[model samples]
Target: MKITRRIHSCVEISDGDTTVVLDPGGFGTPDNLAEVDAVLITHIHPDHVDADALTAARATNPELRIYGPEGLRELIDADYNVVADGDTFSLGSLNVEVRETPHEKIINSKELPENLGYLFNDTVLHPGDSMAAIPDMEVVLVPISGPWLRMLMVDEYLAAHRPKRFIGVHDGVDNDNGLTLRGGLLRQLAKDHGVEYLPLKPGESVEV
Candidate 1:
């Protein structure tokens, strides 16, 4: 399978002619949602779900399917298939499984909606804006930076899960210096665990 990392948490995964899109929010600028078979959403935050982009994506590709957690249907204007924790579905040849995780809490913000983690073909886990104890998978999308994250929290999570490989996401807030600093640390951690760590720039693609 091929995974293309977008600006923020958005990523496009493809196997043959089928594609799965995830989190086309503030930092994500997907080249083509028109060909996407399944679009998985983790939460309803603006930076995590771009309503305008999705609305336009559906407009261009009327058959493009959308999926997410409960109550997310109210936030989005387009039609979507809801997938809660422990739910599993299919998109072409890939098996899509859902796992619930805690949305990183902000001190002053209101309670957030449910956050979902998606596991595709049992290979990759995209935990959206979360840092929870997700099941072991070969590849993982780790949040490198966020409002509710700390350096230690990230370090601990990496050490705990220690997947075969991890790609950095949720990094729109990071400046060059911060990214470099934190990325260096993560690289070392991955090296220690004998895992591959990719801090992919926007538009970069990797095979899994």
Candidate 2:
């Protein structure tokens, strides 16, 4: 399988015959979805869901399938598959398991939106905006920076999963310097936990 990191929390995963994109939001626009089989959205946050871009993509490819929280249905006019916690489905060659990971509560926020993490083929876990850990994962997409994130929370999350390989995500808010500083610190911290941390810039891919 190949995992390509996009800006912010977006990731494209392809398993030879099928390609799936996750969280193509305002932080970054996904490439044309004409050949993409499915899209899994974790939440409805603007940074995680670009309504205009997705609308255009769907207009271009009406066969595209989109799945996410029930709240997402209200945002986009297209048909959708509302998935919650414990939903499992397959997108061509990709096996997916959905875990309802609550978005970390932001200080002074009235309410939090629904969030779900995707576990692909039971090997890779993408925890959208949460630090909620999944066990026995070989690879983990960890959020590095956001309003609800703290360094201690990140440390605890890494200790819990202890995945063999981890990649940082949800970092579009940072400038270049912040990316380098936070990513560097995260690399050393992950090493201390006996995990290999791979830093992927936007548009980079790594095979797993």
Candidate 3:
């Protein structure tokens, strides 16, 4: 499978024939939006679910399927499939398992939204905005920086899950310096836990 990292938490995964985009939000739309077969949303946050982009995509590709938690219906203006914990489905050759993880609490904010992690073909896990525990998977898309996150929390997450490999996501907030500092620390942390840390800049693609 080919994995392409987009800005913030957005990621595109393809198995040659089928292309699925996840979290095409405020950061940016997938480069191949017109060809996207499906879109999986982890939450309703604008940075993770760009309503304008999705609306345009839907207009352009009438067959494109969008899946997300139930609450997403109220936030989005376009039609989408509602999915909750334990749901399983397929997009061409890729099989997806939906696991609900509560959005991390942000101090002084209103109630948190529902977050769902997507496990792809039983190999990769995209845990959205949460660092919640999940079943064993070969690769994990870890959220490295955000308002509800800290270095210590990220360290704990890596130690707890210990996937064979991890790539940072939800990192649009960081400048080059901040990204370098965080990436350096995470690389060492992953090494300490016997996990390989693969860092990809926006628009970069890696095969797994």
lDDT of each: 0.84, 0.87, 0.88
lDDT per residue as tens, model 3, 51-72: 8788788888899899998888
Per-residue CA lDDT of candidate 1, range 1-208, in tens?
Answer: 8999887899889988889889988666576776678788899888888888888888888899999888777776888898889999888888888999888887765787799999889899998888866546688998888888887877788778777788988888889898888888888888777778877788899998
- Ranked by lDDT, the better of candidates 1 and 3 is 3
Writing each residue's lDDT as its tens digit, candidate 2 over 40-150 gives 899999999898888778888999999999999868989889998998999888899999877888877458789999999988888888887876578899998988888
What are the per-model numbers of colliding residue pairs?
0, 0, 1
User: For model 1, what is the C-alpha lDDT against the true structure?
Assistant: 0.84
| Candidate 3 accuracy as lDDT | 0.88
**Which candidate number has the best lDDT?**
3
Instruction: Candidate 3: list runs displaced more than 4 Å.
Output: none
- TM-scores for candidates 1 onward, in order: 0.94, 0.96, 0.96
Cα RMSD for candidates in order: 1.5, 1.1, 1.2
